[model samples]
Target: MPELYERIAERFGELILNCPPDRWEDPSPCPGWTAWDVVAHVISNHRRAIAGLDGSGYSAPGRGEDLPRAWDAASEAIKAALRDPVKARTLLGEEFGSMPFEEFVRRMACADTLIHGWDLARATGQDEGLDSEAVAVATEILLPEDRDIRMPQAFGAKVPSAADADARTRLLNFLGRQV
Candidate 1:
């Protein structure tokens, strides 16, 4: 079976490709951010992670108002980095810092992409679907025992807990998202 991170990366990419350009103008679940803004955030994350892999410092240059262009730039940079052979395996901070290059890439880029995919869907009034295997992997990766709670404080609210929820729900909740 493919690793969870790989599956998530694939699913996230699919979500991005399928997003309707018209809906990019709509507001998403993320407060004060439009669908385009969310996409920009995801793409920016990809760019930063790829930069880390390339031995360059991560950069999250804020995109003031032109979020669509920001998204396009970040996305293209990340896509190019994905084709590179470098691996970023250092732990600069508490997030996925200690993970392997590929795993770090997935946890940071792919999982966020999955969540933002939901944000975009909500903004666009479309169905939200995460790759089941990817969610499961993320759930395991973000278990409370292994979780660093501080990270979500900087990103967004953690995923809310659900009784009898599957791995996906648990993972989403752990990440401070409401599923």
Candidate 2:
């Protein structure tokens, strides 16, 4: 039984590892973000969350850096933090309030990674299918914040989805992805 963040991050990481080098600069579903930019955003978010857990200062992944290497290093640090009971349970700040670092990562970071995985896939011509379980969990967690999610964030305004669309499609639409 993997943690939610682990399961979601696994899919995102797989996409990263398989991304074509030539496609790294290709535009993604995320406006203004290339495929490489999507990966960097995920890595940066992971570093921010774990920074709160372990006091490891946050820094954006540099464009000149090897993003895959940086991503792997951050992933290893995050895994170590998650395994430590004290750090995992420690409170991390958010706009609303504070929750355990594990909860924050599982809820917010998990969803971000899952969605960005889709963006990366769309950009690089890889499979766009998402982990069904991750999509379900993300839908449940994100649906309630529909308005806030639309407000000039990484996500755009909520886009309409077909009534018959599947959970993953609905989730993507709710997060403002046109599917």
lDDT of candidate 2 over 35-149, digit per residue (tens): 9989998898888887777666889888898887888888777777889889878887774249887777777554788899899999999999987888887887887877766
Clashing pairs in 1: 91-97, 157-176, 158-175, 158-176, 158-177, 159-173, 159-175, 159-176, 159-177
Q: How far is 90's C-alpha from truth in model 2 (Å)?
A: 0.4
- Leading candidate by TM-score: 2
Cα lDDT of model 1 by residue, 145-173, tens digit: 44445453234556567688876666666
Task: Say which candidate scores most in lDDT.
Answer: 2
Per-candidate Cα lDDT values, in order, are 0.61, 0.81
Off by over 4 Å in 2: 94-96
Per-prediction TM-score: 0.66, 0.93
